[model samples]
Target: MADNASGDTAGDALPRERKPSNTALAKQRAHIENLMQNVDKPIELPQPGSKKPLLKPPPEIVLNVRGSSAGAGSSDFHTYRELRRKEHLRIKLMEAEAAEDAIGEEFNREREALKRQDEEKTAKNRAKRQKRNKAKQSAKKSKPAEKAALPVADE
Candidate 1:
């Protein structure tokens, strides 16, 4: 039993064998080179009068200040710049107005809620005051009769 246990421990402690670093690196380099070769190869042209080729469409042309003026045959640089600046300012102004309107609507809703809460509190206080006043009036009526009887006794 001891011999079998020692052999099992030795087997468990043994290191696993791995491939050499140079061979592993060489295999990776070969795979990358194969990918590079395929990437540079041109696509075959489709035959005429058959199915159309599935090529990507050309990119859209973007017009900046120089491109726009040149395309439009206009020579004034400062006027173009001014027009672009005005368009940006107009967009910013519109965004600011929209933000202000949204904020105002939220504030109005909060204010109305607070106003309703205050009205409810005032109504409760008014009911309590009316109850106290009724109690005081009943007590006063009973006290005056007692006072009138006491004065006759004293005379």
Candidate 2:
């Protein structure tokens, strides 16, 4: 083997050591100091009962329906039961749809009632304001007529 000037073989090379910068060393020292301060303080753990959900989704009344996987034109008992299962699922879906529609109709009726009530209130207020303005105008018109009726000396 040819000898190099450093007198160390390439296969026996040691890893180069590194020294951290002053800023990094200071940051590490500060982190350790902060950790030491927290060592005496008790860690507040979460309570087990707090894991309960705040709100739960509404229960599903209608389930998803998948088509029958049986072979076509087969009139076995499995196929008959599959047809019955589909009928039941369809009935459940119809019932759920009807229930949702009823809720929507009720909401619309309530909104319509509220709209009519608001319109009536505003119309009454408008009528009262018109009457008040007309009264004020009539009082002003009478004052001028009364002054014209009074006999006055030439100024």
Candidate 3:
């Protein structure tokens, strides 16, 4: 074990610390503070404009039609029954599509109504605030004038 000037050996030196660098620690703290500040922002309720999925075709039903069970090329194929089933499915699909369209129309109408209602509410609140402010200003103006108009005391 060779020592330059002190008696301590090379192996006796303490291991270098592996703590995060100062810049990295400061960046981490800044990120945490940003997250905390963002969390404090008021949460808005999901609007009706958000996605409401329309009807979707079933996977199994779609898979069944892709096979050779409909055409008559195969000896085991059944044509009439498949035709009838396809017709029934088509009719059912039309009906469902129509119903969904109607429902979507209704939802649109309801959204318009809610929007109108909110607008009216905001207008009413603005008018109320303006009226209150005017009243307060008029009251303040009249008070000082009234005090000034009062006759001086006899003393």
> How far is 78's C-alpha from truth in model 1 (Å)?
5.9
The regions of model 1 sitting more than 4 angstroms off are 1-71, 74-81, 142-155
Question: For model 2, how many clashes?
Answer: 0
What TM-score would every model get versus the actual structure? 0.40, 0.48, 0.44
For model 3 the TM-score comes to: 0.44
Model 1 whole-model lDDT (C-alpha atoms): 0.75
Regions of candidate 2 where Cα sits further than 4 Å from its true position: 1-75, 153-155
Q: For candidate 2, lDDT tens digit of each residue in 57-151?
A: 33366353345884545455676687677667767766877898999999999999999999999999999999999999999999999999999
RMSD of 3: 12.4
**What's the residue-level lDDT of 45 in candidate 2?**
73
On residues 51-150, what C-alpha lDDT tens digit does candidate 1 reach at each position?
3323333326635446543555454566678766766766676687789899999999999999999999999999999999999998899898888878
Report how far off residue 137 is in candidate 1 (Å).
1.4
- Which candidate leads in TM-score? 2
Off by over 4 Å in 3: 1-77, 153-155
lDDT of 3 by residue, 34-87 (tens): 778899776667767734434344345533444555554563357547756776
- The lDDT of each candidate is 0.75, 0.77, 0.77
Q: How far out, in Å, is residue 46 in model 2?
A: 45
